[model samples]
Structures are given as C-alpha cells and as structure tokens.
Target: MKKLKIGLLINPVAGLGGSVALKGSDGENIQQQAIQLGATPQAEEKALRALQHVVDYKNKVEFYTVSGQMGEHICQKLQFSHSIVHTTSGKTSASDTEHAINEFENIDLDIIVFAGGDGTARNVTKALNKDIPVLGIPAGCKIHSGVYSVTPSAAGKLLQKLLTGEMLSVSYADVMDIDESSFRQGIVKTKRYGELPVPMDLTYIQAVKQGGIEHDELVLADICADILENMEDDTLYLIGSGATTKSLMDELQLDSTLLGIDAVYQENLIGKDLTALQIEELVADYPKTKLIVSPIGGQGHLFGRGNQQLSAKTLAAIGKNNTIVVSTKSKLKALQGRPLIIDVLDQNVAKSYKGLIKITTGYHDSVLYSITD
Candidate 1:
C-alpha cells in the first residue's frame, strides 16, 4: 500500500477573535483585544480533533510539518510518522506560514492540511509553489473561503478516505478574505485573493461564501413581517447574523449587530454582538428563547460558518424545535437542489438537524428544505 504523505500547519492565533465577537483575528491589535475580552485560542484544539480522525491511518500516512504549535506538537501528540521540515519559535505570523509552505515545496506530499480561517488560506495560496491539494480545519473567525472542510472531523474523514484509496475529485477552490476594518463595522466585503487545488466532496469541503444580498425590498419586508408577527411576548429572540435576520432587526426598530449574534426581547434589542457564553447565559435566564438564523448565501450553511456564538451548549439549551430559519427564495433557488449544510462541530447536535426543515421565504410563503451533516 502506498503511504499518503501529508503536510500539516496550524495557526496558533487563528480563532482568537471568534467567540469574543471581534469579527476576525487578522491583526495583532485585534488578537490582543480578543484575548482581553476572554477569547481563547482554539486552533490547536480544533486541529487535534481533525488529526484524531486519522490516527488509525497513521501506518498508511506520513506527515511533514513545521516545528511547535504550527504542526510539530500536534504530530508528536498523535504519534504520527512525521519529519519537521521547518522550525519556528515564539509568536508566528503569516510570514511564518508562508515560509512553512515554501518548505513543503521541497517534499512531494499528497495534501497540505491547515488549521486556520480565510486569512490562513490566503497565505497558503500566496506561498504555494506547486499544485498540491489543500484542506482547511476552520480554526478562524471568518471562514468564507471554499478551501475548508465543513468541520475539523469532516477534514479527517476526507483524509481517511484518501488513505483508504478512495478516488476523491479535486478542484480549484477560491481563496477569499474580507477586510477586517470593514468587517468590524458590520460591512462584509470579501475579495478573492486567489485559488488553490482542494479535494472536492461537497459532503466534506464547503463552498465559498456568496457575497451580495437580495435587492428585492418587497420580499425581504414580507419575510421580516412574518417573523415579527410570530414574535411572542416574554420570548427572548436570539438573532443570528445575516442580511435576512438583520432585516428583522430593522423591522423591529432595533440596533442590529449585522455580523454578530444579538438578543431581542419583546421586539426590543437587549444584547448586541453576544459571545457563546453570553448566549448560553441569556438562554438560561429566559428559557423561552428562539434562535433565528439565515442560511449563508450560496454556501447554504445554517450553522458553523460565521456564527460560532451558537455553540453546541447554546443550541442544546435553545432546543432544535425552538429555532427558526429564514431565507429569501432566490437564495434557496441558487442552491439548485443542494440541501442546507450543518457543519456544527458537535456531531450529536448536527445529527439532530438531519431531515427536512421549513424556511420562511415571505409573509405567507414557506418551503421545506433538507439539511445534511
């Protein structure tokens, strides 16, 4: 059996800004701010989970990695056969990431698996000296890029398939990043830095986040009106980020955290840009809270894209039946027949989401949509 040689890279500070509601962890200042706000780095832990899924295939796989948290530590912990091709100490930056990829150029590897967000994806594309397949572990805030697997475990599943000699198709996925400055101000402006070859299996890999919004004012208003009419007294509404959900916030005459989770009670804005812990606390108090979320455009992900604040614990407390999904008809149509994706890290919670889900398209228009893990 031929061994599948893999390259691993982990960005230590990749997701430092996520749970703190900083939008992204792109700059040093933002990283410190997120830390000060009590945001914990999850890049290494997330990468560990991805690697755990492939530990059984260690005999069939070999790894080339950078020293320290970048890759070496995780490889050592997993007891995988690996060679440290690059070394780094102290704080790492995009330069370190690029330099590591430059080292990978010297080794003929089957795939380069990285743990970071879109910013890391950009660095990988910028430093690639060859057409090697890449996969992302989604350890960052803004994961709008298509190069990422839906979840860390999903990335492992893909590696497991590759090790078992499964013929997975490869395709060029766009490497996308957003301006952190604008993103902090609730404006989502994504720019395509470049593309990278990624193994394709919609069941595992995700699609690039679709930009732009529905311009049909009537449709948006109708959808918002329906959601407003259904708002019950004493009910705490946890509004998920998106244009559609923001429309509801606008209709309620509330300040919307356009890119962050917000809390509404009796149509009043109470909490803005809430973190996962904050959401859980709020749910514990209210007990009658409903989660309103919209599927990301084009990607059709109702969870695990940009809304990390809705952690598994928060979801379990809110209950699946208490959640409401809203989307424009055009957005759903653009998906063709693809079901909405559920990429939440917790398989138990994600599993409960299988089967058909109803989406509110307008004031009286609704459609049943299927969701997949």
Candidate 2:
C-alpha cells in the first residue's frame, strides 16, 4: 500500500497565556508572565489528540517533522513512522517555524498540519514554497484565521478522512493575524497576511473571525437594562469578553476589561481580567453565579475563540443552566442559518451544550437558537 506523506509542525508555547488571561502568548515576556500566573502549555497535548486519530493508519502513513517539541516529540510519543526534517534547540520562534517550513519544502508531502494560532499560520505562509494543502490545529489564544480546524480532534478526523482516500475538495483559506499588542489593550486590529491551500470541509476548518464593534446603541442599552433589572443580590456575574458583554459592564458604570473576562457582584466590579483558575476559585465562593457570553460575530463560536479563560473545568463549574447567551439580532442574521459553535477543545463538554439554546437579543426579546460542535 502506498503511504501518505504528512508534514507536522507544533508551536510549543502557542497558548500558554490563554488560561492565565494574558490575552495571547505571542512574545517571550508574555509567555513568562503567563507561567508566573500559572498558565500551562497545552499545544503539545492538543497536537497529540490530532495525531491520535491517524495512529491506526501508522503503516499507511509517514510523517515529516522537526526535532524536539515542534513535531518530533508527538510523532515519537505515538510511535508513528516519521522523519525529522529540521532541528531546533531551546525555545522555538517564528524564525524556527519559517526555517522548518523551508525544510519541509525540500520533501514531497501530501499536507502540512501545524499546531498554533494565527501567528504560526503567518510563519507557514512566509516559508511555504509550494501550494501544498495545509491545516491548522487551533492551539493558540488568537484564532482569527480561516486555516484552522474547529478543534484538535476535528483536525485529526480530517486527516483520517485523507488517509482513507476520501474525496475532499482543496481550496484557499485566508491566513489572518491580529496585532497582539493592540489586542491586549482591547483593540482588535486584524490584517490579512496571505492565503494557504487548505482542504475544504466546514466540518473541520473554521471561518475567519469577524472583527469590529456593533453600532446599535439602543439595542445594546436594552440588553444591558434587562440584565441589570434581573440581577440577583449576592450572585456573581461572570461577564465574558466581547463588545456586547462589555456594554453590560458599561451600564453598571464599572471598570471593564474590553477583551478579558471580569467578575461582577450586584452590578459592582469584583475582578478584572480573570484567569480560568481564578474564575473556578471565585465560582466556589458564590452561591449563585451567571456567566454572560456572546458569540463571535462571524464565526458564531461561543466558547473557544479568544475566551480560553473559560476553560472546560470552569464551564462545568458555571453549568450551562446558569449561563447567559447575548447577541445582537444582526450578528445572528449574519450566520444565515448555521448553528452557534462551541469549541472548548473538550468534545464531550461541547456535546453536552449542543441542541436548541436561548439567546438574549434585546431587553424583552430572546429567540431559540441551535448550538453545534
């Protein structure tokens, strides 16, 4: 049987700052700060999950990867047939990613699967010399790009389809990246770096994130009023990141972290820019807590994009029953008919929240919506 040649690249520190509420893990300083705040690197574990789906086809596939944490580690851990195409020492950077891809160009491969966010996608675009198909394992704090699969397991399933010789369409996906410095300050500045050839499958690949703020002031005020009027005494409110949720904090006249999660009690600010662990601890103190979340404008993701502070465990502690889904009518209209996506990287947890859900669109108006994995 002819073996499938696959290229793999892993960014070890891709999402080190997410659970720590650092916004992103782009620079060396930010990564260190995340570590100080108890953020653990999960990119390698996510890569392992993606590779696990293809392990059954070990005899039918060969992998080309870089040494150390970039790719070789996962390949070796899984005992898959693989070749190290490049070597790196210490911590890896965008330069290493570029050089690794340069080496990948020398070998013929079916597809290049990389684990990171939009930054790694930019590096791949910078170094790629051929139009080979590429796919992303969403392991970064920022995933505004369209090249990534919805989740790690989804990426593995896509690879499994390729191994089984399933007919899949190949197309181009935009490689988009945002200015992390500006993102930290609550400003979303996104740019289209380039494009990559990717397999077309909505079930796996995600759409580019929609950036910008809504201009409907009246509707926002109504939503905020409804939330405040219904506020229960002594209950903790976890205000999630996003412009819609920010409006609620603004109505309370409290300090709001534009792009970070905050805690509120009786319309008073309690915690600003909280981490997952911090949120879990705080949830334990409150007898009643509600998590207010809004979906990504274009992608319709409720849990995964730019809100890693709400880890799987945190979501469990909050419980879906105590959750509030807020969105503007226009944002829902933009989805046309697609269901809201929940990609917390835990399939079982994501599945538990699937099905019809209620979304608060205005002060007295809410509609039943569908949630999907």
lDDT per model vs. reference: 0.88, 0.89
Per-residue accuracy of model 2 over 1-373 as CA lDDT, tens digit each: 8899898999999988889888888888998899998888889999998899998999999999988999999999999999988888777888889998888888888899999988899999999989889999999988988999987888999999999999999989999988888888998899999999999898788878777899899999998888888889878999979999999988889999988999999778889999998899999888888899999887788887779999888787777788899999999998877788887767678877889888999988899999887
Model 1: pairs clashing at backbone N, Cα or C within 3 Å: none
lDDT of 2: 0.89
Best by TM-score: 2
Model 2 quality (TM-score): 0.95
Q: Which ranges in model 2 have alpha carbons more than 4 Å from their true place?
A: 346-348
Off by over 4 Å in 1: none
The weakest ten consecutive residues by lDDT in model 1 span 341-350
Pairs that collide in candidate 2 are: none
**lDDT top scorer:** 2
